[model samples]
Target: MNKSTLALAVAVGVLAQQAGAAGFIEDSKASVSSRTMYFNNDNRDGGADQKETAEGLKFDYLSGFTQGTVGFGIDAQALVGIHLDGGKGHHPYPSSFFPSDSDGSAASEWSRASANVKARFSKTEAHLGGALQPNMPILVANDSRLLPQTFEGGTISSKEIDNVTFNVGQLEHAAGRASSNSTGLAVAGGTEESNQFRYAGADWKVTKDLTLQYYHANLKDYYKQDFLGLVHVWPIGTNQSFKTDLRYFDSSSDGKNGDAGYQFNNNGGFAKTPGEVDNKTWSAMFTYTLGGNAFLLGHQRVNDDGGFVYLNQGSVVNDNRRSEEAGGASFYLFTDSMINGFVRAGENTTFGQYSYDFAALGVPGLKASAAYLYGDNIKAKNGTSPDQSEWERDLRVDYTIQQGVLKGFGTTLRHGTYRGSDTGIASQDQTRLIFNYTYSFL
Candidate 1:
């Protein structure tokens, strides 16, 4: 049966049983969220332009566990996207805003639903089926588009240790944020599908101001990766603090990653071994916050072996349908900019941002920020220029209703401009506006 029908069936069955159960109905919660987004991108270097406006409706339900030593519960989600506007060539092939139709146009509307069964013990929990979004350093499910990308997987999380938390799981497939169907996982370049993605990680709260993290992940026949992270926040005074964050990633080829069908594409950048995967990346960010002002400075460096890699399922296209989805990626790095990810081999990037909160001046729920990033010293596989460089600037403003009937309403505006050399990715100026609201229902 379809996901929607299945979700309805599950909801009805659980509610029917809850009439006689103790905790099922008493602890249940449901909510609906709505989002309207407008996107416009102009490629100054004669590249294709993108413009689209869409609306998204999301429903979420969380059921309380039944009384038992190992209580059982369920969670359900439904997502729908309405294609408000995308005229003709605005949303070209492989668009990220919405799913494409059979005739290469934006689909009128699309939807999907999910449900997960979960069990809870003293300090641990297990979840199976439906949606899995692990926000670890190695893998992050993208939620930047109309609908969030979701994975089909089983996960186990435990907080048995006093100051440590653990997460482990295996994902089989993923559904893109714009598509209604799921597909196997694979990085950029290779077309061969890998059905297994296993990961494990832990976070240790070393002290009141410091935390340490470690994670590892492996995609069958693709690549294996390990990550290490450290974060510390030092309070300076009233409403003042200094924060430091350091992250490192080490990745290499796995089973068949060096083979013909499972090779990586190095994100269309330089790969020392053509399709083979081999890279190391590290970044550091320091921030200072005082009163209503915050400033951040960071630097990132990509090793010379190859470009940093991550999962990008854009290669698995299938007739403008299910496959070739899942393109938006959010890596744990400062270089993940709006126009480009400065992850090319042997590249070094320096970036900074400054933000302010209007609440310090009596107006609450309003904020603005601006950031700049400059990258240089990039290397190419074909022995091109060694000093290739690029830069980007972004500005953002956001506000939410602090009181009144529209207390939950939110709006955000963002704009960015990027310029790069011929050896780098195309340059562009992009703008985005979003409005969001949420309401609880029981």
Candidate 2:
């Protein structure tokens, strides 16, 4: 067993002895969530199309802290995914949506379980185990698929100060959204694993409507990244407001970053120093909200040196075989869209979105949004071909049952169309329909 697994076993054993403790048994909570998803992608090029439907069931148990100065608690999660439909030809090998069988077809089903031990002291809390899902400015756990990506790590968060919240963590391995196994961390094109990913950050709420964030992260022998973010809201009326959000990232090579088996693909775009991580990216977004309607606009620029970098284990080889199911990842950027990430070197992208809630029209649980992104001036490899460009359009609709026996049940539909010019990326159209429901048991 791995260290994290062993740790979880020991922690659970200790918790079982205290199972009858006053606070532990009284304040525990459990929940089960279900998601049914239909995913379809049509490749405009000669690539194979993917269409599949799957059902995901997730169970979570959160135990309250034991009664003491330094209280102890535990969180456990179990996930199961069942393949509802997808023929041989439609279920692609090495897919990002589901694990593959020995014959390269989609697996019938997959499941995994994880647990974490936590402690609380004053206004601070610490967690250690294999089910860490962090949502920070530097690393955002991906939950856009059937299951969420999880990490085996230890983290500490403290809100002892009045307006400042601090977070620090070190992660060793990650279980991909579609995989039943865990693997060490790596970048997009990296074949060798980096066992260490450390990060620290803080969020300061300066005023009631303003907040600032800063974070630094390093993947041992891979790359180091720093991020800065600012958000502010100006209230005009009870239901009208203007919001501004700014984000910046600076990334560079770390020890042995450009070596063989550790190369960075630069997101399949041009790189000044090939295989090396060197980048500076910034983005600005503005939003105006009135009643139930919102309008948002944003612009992002990637420096000329390289593409934006983030932790992606897609190319990692494990146990003498390629772990293709461990491929999907998310970054802290507006361009991290459903179809593509417009983060190539020298790329400048402008995007806008308009969304409205139907409550303004007497429907309280319906919403719709449409977004468009256009990117140009992407640096071509070797500076030989003309700069590439790409564009994407997305539409989404969501609704929930507000009353009756099915209250809290929700449905979402999303579609995206993408086209690019000589960028080595495929042109595709994608659509997803999802049904979500959660039940709480205490």
Best by TM-score: 2
lDDT of 1 by residue, 318-437 (tens): 454336555566677878877688898888999999999999999899999999999888876575645688899999999999899999799999999999886546789999999999
Alpha-carbon shift of residue 98 in model 2 (angstroms): 0.6
In model 1, how large is the Cα lDDT of residue 192?
Answer: 71
lDDT of 2 by residue, 23-86 (tens): 8868999999999999999999989999999999999999999988988899999999999998
Q: Which residue pairs in candidate 1 collide?
A: 316-324
Off by over 4 Å in 1: 1-20, 317-322
Worst 10 residues of 1 by lDDT: 317-326
In candidate 1, position 269 carries an lDDT of: 67
Q: Give the runs in model 2 whose Cα sits over 4 Å from its true position.
A: none
